[model samples]
Target: MRALIIIDVQKDFLANGFLVVPEGEKVIPVINNINHHFDVVVATKDWHPASHKSFACNHHEREVGEIVEVNDLPQILWPAHCVSNSDGAKFPEDLNTKVIEKVFEKGTKEDVDDYSGFFDNGKLNDTGLHDYLQSKGVKEVYVAGIALDFCVKYTALDAKALGYKTFMIEDASKGINFRPNDVQNAIIDMKVSGIRVIHSRELEKVFSGDY
Candidate 1:
């Protein structure tokens, strides 16, 4: 069956919040429209801890946007965002959450930074997102929401590797920096990795009752 994966459409990613992505809130209406067309709606949230190493605040001498290697993975130091139970961590109230059957919380552990909904720092950890989706018989996934360069892009790539036919709705996503090239690069990466990248308008033709 086809599932809609909404990645980190949270208040923190909005215009006035910390770590806001440019025009991030604009994708909400598009995501809402897409959610109704799919059978299963899976939403992911960036539920990080205050001491999460991915945050620059946790690094004594590091500044935001600095790249540091952690566990052999390149980790970008971000402004403190989406700490668990904080206002920034909650999904946007404007988003229609009723249709979301499953909610996956990522980046909970202070040690690991989870950009993908399926795994933490590209590894399977405490989050049971993959198993939950498998239990629901989800085979093909259509992804949308938040920053295209980080969360959304990584999630799409990981979904493809997990043996699911993945698609990212281009128009329904926005980038962190107002960088158009990053979005274009992500589209290329998705395509080369065998993941489909299409505009939101094309979703109806691509997504039918069955995969």
Candidate 2:
């Protein structure tokens, strides 16, 4: 079976939101159009507590884009965006949430940052996404969503590591690109790690059993 994993298409990542990823909202229609091509559709959200340590506001003398250590793991300080129960943490109104069979919430721990849907920053805690996919007999995963260089990239890498055939839909995602060429570098890294990078248009071939 195949699954489509949509990662962090929440309002917080939109252009008007707190942690805007360039052209992030552009992926929504693409994701919605591809929903029916997969056997299962799953979505992930960054549901952080108000005082989560990943936020730059919580750290004294630290600024956004600075690297700090959280639970001994290198963490990037970001503007507070996806606080739990906030509007920014919710999926955008345009996303087709009805097609999503499961919605996984991550980064809930105040002390840990979770950039991957499957695990926390340290990979010490899983969000149950792996077990869920295994239980559903999903052998391959197609990933798409906002911030391709961060949450989307980590999720796809983790999916590959867990023995699933992973593919990232390039046109169906966007990136923060905090630094120059960050998205380009992330695509190279993901491809090097065995994740096939494809465009959203190729999904039609996949659904037709022609790829």
Candidate 3:
């Protein structure tokens, strides 16, 4: 079976978000159009606590976009956006949530940051996504959503690492582009790591189920 992994389409990543990704809202229509193409649909959320170390405000004088060391991990400081119960953390009303069978939350651990839906940055802990997908007999995964250069890229790499055939839906994912070429570099990283990067249009014939 195949699954669609929608990564962090929360309000904070959208146009008026605290840490807005370039054209983040553009992914909504693409994802909504292709979500039902798979047998299962799952989403990921950036559920961070107020005191999470990845937030620049938590550090003495660090600013957003600065890289800091946390628990020996190189953590990129971000503007506090996805606070656990905040409005910014909630999925947008435009997202088709009814088809999402489950949602796996990440970045919950204050000590470490989690970019991938499957595991924490250190790979010390998992978000139970792998086990759930395995239980559902999903051998292939199509990943899409906000921040293509960060969360979406990491999630796709981790999906391939976990023995699943992983593909990144380019048009359905937006990039934060901290650097001008972040999105391109992310695509290179995925390709070298054995993950296919594709557009939504190509999926029609490939995943042609009655879904």
State the lDDT of candidate 3 residue by residue for 14-47, as single tens digits.
Answer: 9788889889999999999988788999999999
Residue pairs clashing, model 1: none
Give the alpha carbon lDDT tens digit for every residue of 85-105 in model 2.
Answer: 999999999999999999899
Pairwise lDDT winner, candidates 1 and 2: 2
> Would you give me the overall lDDT of model 2?
0.93
The candidate 3 region of ten consecutive residues with least summed lDDT is 202-211
Report how far off residue 129 is in candidate 1 (Å).
Answer: 1.8
Show the colliding residue pairs in model 3: none
Cα lDDT of candidate 3 equals 0.93
Which tens-of-lDDT digit does each residue in 1-211 have in candidate 1? 7889999999999988899898999899998877877878988999987999999989889999898977778888999999999999888888999999878999998877998888888485846767877888989888899888888998999889999989998889988854458877878888999998888888777755332
Q: List where candidate 3 sits over 4 angstroms from the true fold.
A: 208-211
What ranges in model 2 sit over 4 Å off?
207-211
Residue 152 in candidate 3 has what lDDT?
96
Q: Give the C-alpha miss distance for residue 55 in model 2, angstroms.
A: 0.3
